[model samples]
Target chain A: MVGVRVDGTTRLMGIIGDPISQARTPQAINPIFAGKGADIVCVPLHVPADDLATVWAGLKAMPNLIGFGVTLPHKQIVPQLCDSLDPLAARIGAVNVVRREPDGRFRGYQFDGQGFVRGLIAQGVVLQGRDALMIGAGGAAVAIAFALQQAGIARLVVANRTFDKAEALARAVNEATGTSFATAGAPTPESGQLVVNATSLGLNDSDPLPLDVSMLQAGMTVAEVIAKPEITALLRAAEQRGAAIHSGIHMITGQVSLIADHMIAALG
Target chain B: MVGVRVDGTTRLMGIIGDPISQARTPQAINPIFAGKGADIVCVPLHVPADDLATVWAGLKAMPNLIGFGVTLPHKQIVPQLCDSLDPLAARIGAVNVVRREPDGRFRGYQFDGQGFVRGLIAQGVVLQGRDALMIGAGGAAVAIAFALQQAGIARLVVANRTFDKAEALARAVNEATGTSFATAGAPTPESGQLVVNATSLGLNDSDPLPLDVSMLQAGMTVAEVIAKPEITALLRAAEQRGAAIHSGIHMITGQVSLIADHMIAALG
Candidate 1:
């Protein structure tokens, strides 16, 4: 209980995921939720993948539940459940946070995109006129990439184990915004100003490296989207290589605050 | 920003319902969630009836959501959302609350059944050896009738506009609880000692009356489940006739504390 909750006066925020015990949201954002109000609390809800519909019927029935953050598996599914969704959230094809209204309706939003943008700013990394290397083309990676353009990154490259998925995502983002800030390939010859690893690899104690962190260079900013086991192997390796590091924890904290603020505003 | 929330030291509780705004759980239970260092905050989550599966998926994914007092439209549906459900909730064919664990699994329980029993005891009304009259076979009424038997009522007569549903619910409670208190049809000849109106007979300004006080005896006790218009016409009439009355507001308050306690014990 000592480390589980925030002090009084904080508002409430939460992230829902399957296998929630392994999530980092509880540890990273509960404090921030408390910091904002000392009256707030952030909780992690583990909703099963199969019974999503039935449980949802009952959850929305409770008048006291304010809003919730969605995670893997459910993230993509949340958009379809919304009566009306944020344009960006719908375009991103997933939602990491939702705002519940007085009418028992949930409006979906993708905070992860904006959160990462805020993260870059927090670490003094300027996104404008910068070329970046983003590893993986998964949900988190895609969301982060979408957020990157908003932060003014001029050019980008997306590297992944599966070239097709990466290419599809890059093409989608490019086609949607016509900004052409993202691309797909293997570890290529083009150097980048910022490099980010978004895959789950390098997270577990025994997981393999998803990307060549060795490709990182001096003066280049490196970031890892993995929050738990806070210092993933790739991040440590990046640090060892003298690359400036902007941890994903910053993104999580910023996102929690942003999501809570958004929900509060929506509620009002 | 200025309200109670469940943190590490706080407990968790919820009031489950769709269209949750019409319910008043935050007012009744938030104080209790804060009373014992349990940073409980009740949120109003509006789950669309069609998107039930998605809502459940979102809810089960979080690690912090605990118990809840489920409400209208979802009472019957909540039981299916759980991996394990209370027999009483299962028997009543409904659930009003669910308990989530640290591991993120949700277990369903029907607190309305027990809360109603406690409401009777708090008023020093012993159900044992006392004949009772229950009006309506709706969600709340069914729960109250099941609870009455648990309190040792001698016999119960269920009355409803649709007499068949009331008779059916009475039979269901009798079969599942193994209590002989349930009976078909409405109370006849005013023979019941304890009369209860669980329908929305006296709500807002012009709600219809469900019970006829014409045959009420002076020593009999009458209870109403309507929270607003606390002084219901039936209860008021019973009071005028020198009969004791347990206002619906008392039931609402009792249920909130009961649910908060359930969460504290379950989550702690």
Candidate 2:
């Protein structure tokens, strides 16, 4: 938690979600504001799905609120509510953050994919011309898949339990990027240079691995999207096979600064 | 300023007003929450008049919000927007605080008058059967006037620049309490046992006294409603006239704990 001295003049920001007690954005970003001596405080708002529209209208009318972050059940539905969307966010059909403009219009932006890519790059992992195998066709997978393509990946094989959803995501990415760079297929850990577990498989100790750990190659790199355990079973197996590993925590650490910067830049 | 550690689980309360930068509630009440080690934080929300309805809707939908305080232009209009109001608040047609029930209904409560009377009583300035001369007939004056009658004040003389407004307030209080203990009249400093300066005249240094200080006798006690410049010109002159003077800061000090207790009690 951040030590904040909130007063009448302090600017406001928050993360809106249902079952919001588990959200970490407030703890992650409030420290950045405090360190910079910025008079901004980020709190959590537990707004149910039915109340989003009413809450949004009130947020717009708040003169001192700079912006707020969207999470879980809200990312996809929030884009339509935004006054404008970043071109990439529009193409991806999801938004993870929204900034309030001086004219009182809210512009949405997608940072999940960008955060994943930035996290990998910051860790010195190469993405250009790499052949990657991504598991799952959920929201996180969709964002990461597009980001991998944008980062100059030679090809991407999207693997999921429901093959139809995976194929749909691959086709959408290909159509938007104007390249035959994505395909729907089963996860082949031995063949791909990079493997990403974007599913919730690693969240619990009893959960099965998203891919074949035995097929993991010595030179391959395995990454995960489950942040709670930090070292997921899949990543542990991959490391034992002499492969490099990346934890899902980086996705959050990589975006906290970006989220704070986006909201502060709009203040000027 | 209170040092607050804000996280997702912290319950929220705030002060709502236009030009809210001058509100002292946040600074006053947050420390009480922190002192009790309670996971409750009080912030400030600047909601303009036109957006009150929209903001009120949003606040009701926030599951983690316990309640909020209403100030300035909002105090009088908020009662009608409430699902229910304390009988005294409805009678006075004003509310300074509100609590959100678990069932989602918002109930408004008035504490301004109680606070003023409590402040005087806390300092051992007796109110039982006292003859008092109260200046001004504004919102604060109205709350204080009704409270004084409830506290068993023998008689209350309501005075204002506009005589009609004073008469109307006196008539309303008398009718509601079923007592002929209040009247509309000019401020006669020498006649009353207690003199209350409820007008805004004592706010600025260059302004005239709410009543003639020459007639303020040694036995009479003078009280004020202006918190800033704790000792107003009227208070200073009354002190020089050998009268017991009470500063306005006690009103806030007297009510802060009461407000906090009201919101927290509903949480159970």
Candidate 3:
């Protein structure tokens, strides 16, 4: 029977995305807000892509609106609306979190990469001087690649169903990191110390594993960025192969705490 | 340590007003939502007057937004944005509640007057064929005057510091009721079975009483519409003179259930 105790003075926060009914941020962060005794509740707001700018403008005008979480279609667009972006988010070309500064300016940051990296680190997986292979060149893939590069990974390979997208993401990462570490490659689990599934393939029960998990080896780390069905087929296969497995829930759980901290500090 | 349990699917309700820090609607209604086993949370939104149109447009586009409560500066303006208004709200020219119909249309309603009348009835004060004196010609007073007329009150005398405003309101009420039962008068407790203070005078501790409570008789019923502090000097003085006293909380308590019911039905 414990419920959210929101009143006139409770500060406002929301997660904005198209088809927002599937978002888990509210359930993840609201409980944290309660635990911290923060008078804030984050709700899901269904802001279609066409209405993103208009809705964002209106939300910014609200004096009690503390901040918001950005997801899906809007993530790449939100960075353009921010007054400033964290260097990492700028490099990734997307934003997953927006904080309203005390001076009333909005600053955007991407937490997907940080969340993934945190989850890996929590499982005792080291990225520094390691070779990592990322599957997909979509939004999540790009963020994780940049985060891995930033974490000092010695080499990074991006594989995609569309080779052009993988090459483009590799170029972006290489240019941003000032290194020749990132390259486009076909899906493989044979040579990397870290393997990541950053695609939507693992979301459905019938969806194929994003990569060749049959080649997974002991001591190698496997990670997923998809949240639904926390233990994806990829993770299960990696687990059975004696590979250290990181489920999508770890990324969400890790990001929730970081995002909450960033939002609270921004409110100050 | 109980906190609001909000997930992506939780329905949203908000109180829209300027200077929203003092509103009690969220505290009153959110608990009721929990009691009803509804996954809903009401929050306070400080929407300034200048951004009302833009923000309202954004709000209307939110597919999960159930409804909103309107307050000062917005109450009179919200009905214009709604697709329809309840007849009582249309006549009162103000709306305190709005519900989003299943057809995606918003309907406006005013519960203040009904709440006051309900409170009066709860205190065993009958309005039918009874003479009533209402102090103030402001928003609350106008609504109460119309509600009293609708309840079959034989006569209503509206008194205010500005006689012109009182006279204008009396004209509107009389025209709406198609009867000359309401008139402008000076503040007095001398000749009515029911006397109500619908003005802001009772909000401050040092302000003078809205009416002459010295003339209150044992058979008279006295009521105040200010919710804070519950009891006002006028009600205290009336109580001392053995008059039936109705505190402001009764109006709020009486309306909470009614408003909750309206919002829930609107969600369907």
In terms of TM-score, the best-performing candidate is 3
Give lDDT tens digits, candidate 1, residues A134-174. 88888888888888887888877898888998899899889
lDDT (Cα, 0-100) at A47 in candidate 1: 67
Tell me the number of clashing residue pairs for each predicted model.
55, 0, 2
Candidates' RMSD to native:
8.0, 2.8, 2.7
- The CA lDDT at B12 in model 2 is 89
Residue-by-residue lDDT tens digits, candidate 1, B1-268: 1344333333345454556556577656676666776756665554555655666665554445565566667766778778887777777677777888556677777767577767778778768889888888887787888788878888888888887898888888878877666887755426548888878778856775676677776778888787678798877788887788888777876777787787777665
Better of 2 and 3 by TM-score: 3
Ranking by TM-score: 3, 2, 1
Top-down lDDT ranking: 2, 3, 1
Model 1 ranges with Cα > 4 A deviation: A1-15, A21-45, A56-67, A84-87, A100-107, A185-192, A210-215, B1-12, B16-268
RMSD (CA, Å), candidate 2 to true, equals 2.8
Please give the distance, in angstroms, between residue A125's alpha carbon in candidate 1 and its true position after superposition.
1.5
For model 2, residues B11-124, the per-residue Cα lDDT tens digits are: 889789998888888878889888877788888888999999999999888889888999877987899899999998898788999889878799999998888888898999
Candidate 3's DockQ is 0.59
Q: Which residue window of length 10 is worst by lDDT in model 1 chain B? A: B1-10
Report the lDDT tens digits of candidate 3 across residue range A1-268.
2356787888988999988888888888887777788888888988889988788888888888888999888987899999999998888788999988899888899998888887777767788899888899998888888888878888888999999999999998888878887899988875547888899998999998887778998988888898788889998899999988888888888889888888877666
What TM-score would candidate 1 get against the native? 0.58
DockQ of each: 0.13, 0.61, 0.59
How well does candidate 3 score on lDDT at residue B183? 94
| lDDT, model 1, position A1 | 23
